[model samples]
Target chain A: MINSISKVINDVGLHARPAAEFVKLASGFQASIKVRNLTSASAWVDAKSIISILMLGVSKDHEVELMADGLDEELAITTLRNLIESNFK
Target chain B: MHYTLVDLLKSEHIMMAVQAADAKAAIELLTAALVESGYAEPEFSVDVWKRELAFPTGLPTQPVAIAIPHADPDHVNNSAVCIGVLATPVEFGQMGTDGSIKLLVNIVFLLAIKEREKQVAMIQQLITLIQSPALLAGLISAKDKNQVLDLIQQTLNEEHK
Candidate 1:
């Protein structure tokens, strides 16, 4: 299954702490999740990797697409989308 | 596998004065340069930037400023290093704490490694280099890539011995 959601980076940027937090959150679910820039047609990267997310150069106003495939795909997508939408607040 | 900093850095890794206005531009330019040097795949740079944004790599120093650009091993297509010297200092999120950093960051060590374990020695060597005030000054003041490479080699060699 495939689901897509877009959100602007609300925080200053995803820097280390936020990145680590995002990874920790993503790692909890067994489903495979990948995030990518909506403007860039690159393969989705492992959502749980801090390094992978940082390389995307996502800044404020940059839109990202999160994709997931697995048994709990819906829950994973919704949760991640909410996380991004709320800017991890 | 054993690799020297010289082996990790290629001709393309050497960029003079990057004309980026902000962090995003800086990251894009640096990543493209790494790809050109064959140090990493084209996609690898973007991966690194994305990861960096998520987890800022700026490490605060006592006498000078430095940042180590590293990303998940899965995003790396090869084992290599890229260096960047910004024309103007940019804000890098503080390492190990919640703060903002705006130092004249003259050095950026972009590491693209295939295996996380293999990076231990290199990381140790880098930590040593950072702790040395004299060496750090020499690195920041080095005029060219040759000088930078030589300094790195000397420092690493000294650490090994």
Candidate 2:
């Protein structure tokens, strides 16, 4: 199990399109992935669910925690972190 | 006074059936309605269409599919969410995919947000309502604009309480 915290830099945060894109990528991995918005005080939610991601109420500069525990934990965390860093571009 | 989303929806006279050939038409039709109601400028529709081409708002929700077609704040005169229930679902590219993939969208939640910063918060509330199967059922089963508005108002207000 591994987890990391990072801020959402996208203009819209992890809402609609960006959240959907992140969920799509996270679902491709075999790891059990979850995300929590530290800024919003939201609980961890299934990373593969776009709607759940939106529930985090993440806005730009909102810090989020991503956790993964499975065979692809490392890969999942890396890719997910990079995706956020790239602003979902 | 802070206007709630429901208030904006009602004041703008948004929420209606849309008969369009595709997503582009649906967006145009909704934005045109807003313009006719004196909510948005005429150019807002065109800008929204372009933004749809760039970053699709199609959300592949369960039980029912929906989309949110919107543009930059510069194009809007007032912040309103114009609901357009497409008679026939149209194809819209998935967001953040740069148009590589598409989804069939039947409900268009065209957002006329005057402030870009507020868009995320509004979407969060909307997604919360949409995440519930029962609420989604309520939204999908609504018959007309008033019914849709009622369902939304009831649901959103319930969430607050």
Which candidate has the top score in TM-score?
2
For every model shown, what is its TM-score relative to the native structure?
Answer: 0.60, 0.64
- Please report, as a residue range, the 10-residue window in candidate 2 chain B with the lowest summed lDDT: B115-124
Candidate 2 C-alpha error for residue B24, in Å: 0.5
Overall local distance difference test of candidate 1: 0.66
lDDT of 1 at B106: 56
Model 1 docking grade: incorrect
The sequence of per-residue lDDT tens digits that candidate 1 reaches over residues A5-57 is 57666765554455556666777777878888665554455676555565455
Interface RMSD for each predicted structure:
11.6, 10.0
Cα RMSD (Å) per model?
11.9, 10.0
lDDT of 2 by residue, B29-136 (tens): 888888897778899988988867755677778777778777756667877877877777889887535566789887777877674434445666776776666766
Q: Candidate 2, which CAPRI tier? A: incorrect
Q: What 10-residue stretch in candidate 1 chain B is worst by lDDT?
A: B94-103
DockQ of each: 0.03, 0.11
CA lDDT, every model vs. true structure: 0.66, 0.76
For each prediction in turn, the share of the native Cα contacts (below 8 Å between chains A and B) that it retains comes to: 0.00, 0.17
Indicate which candidate wins on DockQ: 2
Tens-place lDDT digits, model 1, residues B57-144: 6666656676776676655667777777666666665443233444445566677777544444455455667767777677667788
